[model samples]
Target: MTELGYAQAPAVAAREGVPRPCLGCGAPMAVTADAQLHADATLTCGFCGRSETMPAQAAAQDRYLRLRLMQVRRAREGMEAPLKTYEMMRASGVFALIVFGAQGGWMLWGAFTTADKGSAVFGMLGAAGMMGVILANFGMMRAFRKLIKPLQQARPPAAPGLAARCRSCGGDLPPVRSTHATCAFCGANNFLDNAAAHDVNALLTAEQQDYKVRASGGKPGDNTIYQRPAHAFYVWGAAGAAVTFVVGVVLVLVLV
Candidate 1:
């Protein structure tokens, strides 16, 4: 037995017989059985015939496959209602802010001009409407933050170059500008027809993993709520509420 990249030498010949090729190097592989009855594997290069072991490499490959499967699941979850809710909340926040600002201006003007009691009533109604809009904006912003919080908490997707694999040969290829490439070994020109496929795959994987984690009771924590940017309307609402209260007070004082 001989040490390879990351595998240790096996102790005895395996009962299961030798594997024809090394899983990692594609060299002729041998199997050995240990006292514990576990089979440890090693490889001898076909051309060089260099003795090498790769049990650790095999274990790592298994882990990678599991991780990729998890990622696919997460991506599917991301395409669901949670994403839509986030978009809706974001749009509503913007709409509420705009409506509040426009109506606030009108209300302020009505407060100053009123020939009759009805005009004064209209002014009070406008003030209430503006307050409602401001509150609505705050609610929308809060909802938006909740929706995107999971995405923000989840790990980012793998870099494009790292995620991509050759479609035809299943080999890791260098980042190339051209989608079509001749495989160095197989002579397949369409080894990976879509260069962006890796990126898309990674994104989907991340989303799927995130969704599973979130569904399993993993959350971004309460701290994420405070991390969200304060909605502008919240500030405006506080200011408008204060101003309205003051103006009403002044009017009462002047009338008395």
Candidate 2:
């Protein structure tokens, strides 16, 4: 039962694959909540007869909304570099389409309409140069698509446990080294022994892996997320192509 005066179900969540080592005896600690639940709970070391108090929120780490929110923020911050790189690549593609597309259209127009043979030959050279630019731009886009593939699939590296929060009022707790903490807001005493802290830290570590996977552009359980910046390149590229075709039609009509 929680402090809210309701009967809570016994936790059947999957155990951390490796058993947490007992702080006292360096043996495997109990995996179930009844054996390891903190908040005035006791865990006796089966190997050494040593008793340890659990952390204040060890059993209820998932229920803390503040802690979960912090995890999300941390995951997004972890992917900041890749996300920024993708956006920069997308912007450069758009800039190239505008500048190169205009230059190419002008060169092709001059090649067709020039009266002097020398000027016409120069315009033809410019038109060839424009075709090369278009091909190079296509190749660059492909390279960028490959560049962000690794980034989108990248996972966050392991990090330290997040700062602990007060169980009663959700206030931040100073580095917890002892067996108890007094919440500044609610004045409720909380348990936070070394064994409990270890368990809680372990939970945070596992949750961070999932959080990072989702934040880096992939859905939960998915290996890759749909990268919007990369997708934008194709979308704008199509639009630019359509505009160039329309301009070509207009030029043909005017020149004929």
lDDT of 1: 0.45
Q: Rate the local accuracy (lDDT) of all candidates.
A: 0.45, 0.46
Worst 10 contiguous positions by lDDT, candidate 2: 1-10
Q: Report the Cα lDDT for residue 238, model 1.
A: 64
Which residue pairs collide in model 1, if any? 71-205, 73-208, 74-207, 74-208, 74-209, 75-207, 75-208
lDDT digits (tens) for residues 26-96 of candidate 1: 76654432222133344455665566554675634433443343344344333332444435545675566
* Model 2 spans with C-alpha error above 4 angstroms: 1-82, 91-95, 115-141, 144-147, 150-256
**Cα error, candidate 2, residue 146 (Å):** 3.7
Which ten-residue region of model 1 has the weakest summed lDDT?
1-10
Q: Give TM per candidate.
A: 0.31, 0.28
